[model samples]
Target chain A: MSASSRRGVDVGALVEQARDGSPRAVARLVSMVEDASPALREVAATLAPHTGHAYVVGLTGSPGVGKSTSTNALVGAVRARGLRVGVLAVDPSSPFSGGALLGDRVRMQEHATDAGVFIRSMASRGHLGGLSWGTPQAIRVLDGAGCDVILVETVGVGQAEIEIASLADTTIVLLAPGMGDGIQAAKAGILEIADVFVVNKADRDGAQSTVRDLQGMLGLGGRYADDAHWRPPIVKTVAARNEGVDDVLAAIDAHRAWLEKTGGLRSRRRERAAREVEAIAVAALRARIGDLRGGVALDSLADQILDGKLDPYAAADALLAETSD
Target chain B: MSASSRRGVDVGALVEQARDGSPRAVARLVSMVEDASPALREVAATLAPHTGHAYVVGLTGSPGVGKSTSTNALVGAVRARGLRVGVLAVDPSSPFSGGALLGDRVRMQEHATDAGVFIRSMASRGHLGGLSWGTPQAIRVLDGAGCDVILVETVGVGQAEIEIASLADTTIVLLAPGMGDGIQAAKAGILEIADVFVVNKADRDGAQSTVRDLQGMLGLGGRYADDAHWRPPIVKTVAARNEGVDDVLAAIDAHRAWLEKTGGLRSRRRERAAREVEAIAVAALRARIGDLRGGVALDSLADQILDGKLDPYAAADALLAETSD
Candidate 1:
């Protein structure tokens, strides 16, 4: 039987269409990844050869820091350079939460008509392996679709933000003048991940101070250990007015160059792939353990722990043995 | 040899001392949990029989919503009722972040000298199974220490907060006036998890409107579809002044009573124990996967996936087989 016939989804055809620049096919592939479909293995195998082509840029900050506006502007700038761009806005809000962040995507309506630009918003909640698994799978879909650049925008919550940083080739940490994001950026461990820092809403008061604050903190953090190391640059932007966006683009390009020059890009992608593999493996193990709930294994183990006859670690050891078997 | 001689930690002595209300022993046991020490299995086994005695009350909300204040007030209320209380302030902030929340624990210091009260702050970052594994282990420590009530206070970040809700017998969601927390609550999926809601800073403007907004939303959500259902009661409090804290305590008591009357308490505990067991197992499985990174199996699989020669799911299958072996 043909590979397509073996699976519910015609993975081979869909992947071929996605590579031929069909947005519908790309969207369907991404949806399948998001849903964690049974045919995901087939989809991934089909798309594997076409990925590693897209440059992923991650933008993250607290809510209302103009992530959508900045992403929209970046898409325009990247497209001006005659490159296909994909925008993946990872909404940190719960799925049940009203789509406030998703609603913000209306600003990207200008790019809706451009065939070169694909915009999609993912609710970063309730995924099988959490956001880490679903996000990279979606990125692979876009990359397979021949995108030159993929921009990932996420609300800067603590752990989720860190996970996104690991996925991107370049990470831009956004801040606003009056948002007290300087302190928050430090608190959220954004300084360590930011390849480029964009101080959005620079037209407002305290913009210079915010920039200075970042520079001072960066110096104190000793982020630059040597002259050979690439130091993150701070770019001021008025994204709402589409101002200073070119500078942000330049910063991104500069970082990409440093990465390519140092062979950091290859190493980073290697590390990311390792994490992706590990995450999938862990999720699969967890699912197997979950499947055992239907049997007497997990419930009985839990009962033993609950009744104080066995500790959790011992029960876990029993579970591991059973699942491994 | 005794079990204590087999491990680095004298688990039996520690558990015995903690059961005798030795604060140092309780602190040591909790520290072991937080650190995920090698002796943790022994500790859990020792503490198991002593658990399932303390009632877990989770207090969570956005930063600056007075979680610490409300927690402090509730501790006092519980103390007034002659109950031994354990306050576990689970700091959801990154450990690298300045200890801003750790500073918040200063407010809980009045109970510092009280032998009946044990307050500990845990950074909810970098634990093995995220916060799920560590928090409950710490709760077990406190429960074994003879706490009648254990309060788990966490910042209402997305996933972490939901995990905390599951750990608690009663989850109290705190919101301050003018924080627009009503919309945030629904967005964070707190409405479904909240066993009781507290509108803190009731003296502030918009307190009544906040209450009304919550009531309207709760009514619309139909949380009380049947008469037997426990509709989460809204208690207004100026936690700073200790005003209305008694009412909050009463609300908690009422929820506990309802849980017991409906046999929900036993089921919830059973479910929590199951989750605890599962989390431990998952963490153990992940650790095994992590260990494989030192071998050629994981790195080679990652290299293949990075080169686009293999898909992640296929790689994961290989990893599971290797780990199982």
Candidate 2:
């Protein structure tokens, strides 16, 4: 709606401006992505060459685990090192703010006018495939826009949070005392995905105990055993007071160094690329199938299943056959 | 691994026993489903004749909004009315007890040995497509069993919970007074999926205001406005005390009745079937892609992208082509 947005900058211009680290251009580019505009493919084609440079880190924990505060602290530290930072919080907890944008913005208001930081809150709208559907593309936009670092955050409560693991190079599973026991987290499958553990709210009473619980659980796994070169480290932080925040960053830096040294970085990025592509292809196929619904073919398929003449698996096979054409 | 479980009971026998309202048979069948056993297709085929009688209901809200207590109360009320109830909690929290099953069982202990109730807590392991991957199949097993009503409860904090709405005939969104404002819920996109809203913990000070706020927000939504048949009714309850719980059931029943009268029930179920089938097909395709990874074709494509000789879209196209064969 602004005069200096998409209306002012054409598709190529927008991508170019964005790659030059213009926050407004970046915002406009992502908004286009969120809208699923026709020109998005154009943006992607344009952004293709410039991506794969930024390092993506995911911050996840259950709600009230101080993810926002930690993200704020991380941004400050990363910015102090003079790196442009991009924050994408895939929040599903707000109506007006979309992904708790208002709350996140208020929590991260210190970076409000900082030219070195670009933050966008993706509302959980058009949530296809358990993410903002356009998130990977938006990450490309930010990465293509020349951000040195991008932090992807999600509520670490459900299956959707796993998307961040696939997207990020380094995943920090932030925790607060009394959130839950270690078994709860392991069973939740967070243990497998976490590269670094941040015990946020370290001033809280159970912080040491929480750290111990996590350590004891980690010991039970072969996670850092034998073939593992880099074990996930738990860094405690009172994010509210900004204490031990630098230690957390140092842990991340260490993890990054380990990744590069072990050649795990390339594998991770390659897998991320492959996964992203597969998701897109599946989404495309889904769209094709979705378009077929309400038509006679799909309705009759539904009818046959409802009539018990066809089971769901057979019906799905038939649908897949239709798609291959 | 049990003596009389899958190792002993053949698929046909399992199906027969499950249909005879055998709790052990149902549990075994569901476990087989959770394992994604090769006999699953046979099981689904065999049980196809007996499903569709159970009226599925979904209860969801953010974690700790009293969903468990409310679900327990609803089960008690429904069972008192002579309906055999089955409960499935798709919990992503906790390591050992998926969906706080231990706590859930403790709360609903009175119904434990009733023989009419079958309770299952699905761990959010093998999280394929924002669900436990076993949920839809497990529902089929439960539906095929003799339960007259099945309740699906999920921690309504992430994208996966939306799948519940598609799977159930009616979705009840549970909220506590301090959960946040109407904007948060709306932003979370829970507004669209909820067929009914239950404000649990009504004794809290802001309880009335929560109801009022929800009512005001509902007024803004055109969800049922054009249909004019059933607007989502907000029911207040202190589920722990079991008061006002029946009203929630009544609201669900009313929604169910309206759905039946309008032919909406059939449409909803039909859509659910279609969606489930599509999800299965997509998951299968994803598995195919996964299998092909590290193979020559996928590696070359990945290399092409990394080398900047080909873009991700093109790589994805090449990958999707490989899956069809």
**lDDT: which candidate is best?**
1
User: In model 2, what is the error at residue B187, expressed in angstroms?
Assistant: 6.8
**B220-289: candidate 2 lDDT, tens digit per residue:** 7654633445788899899999989989889988888889888999988888887777777787777788
Which 10 consecutive residues of model 2 chain A have the lowest summed lDDT? Answer: A1-10
List where candidate 1 sits over 4 angstroms from the true fold.
A1-8, A59-83, A93-116, A126-131, A153-164, A172-227, A232-254, B1-8, B16-23, B47-132, B139-266, B289-297, B322-325
Candidate 2 deviant stretches above 4 angstroms: A1-273, A294-299, B1-9, B61-66, B94-99, B131-133, B158-163, B173-227, B233-250, B304-310
lDDT of 2: 0.80
lDDT of 1 by residue, B113-151 (tens): 898998887876554545677888899889878999999
Candidate 2's fnat? 0.41
Query: Model 1: what TM-score for its first chain?
Result: 0.89
- Candidate 2 chain B has its poorest 10 consecutive residues by lDDT at B92-101
In DockQ, how does model 2 score against the reference complex? 0.28
Instruction: Give the Cα lDDT of each candidate.
Output: 0.85, 0.80
Clashing pairs in 1: none
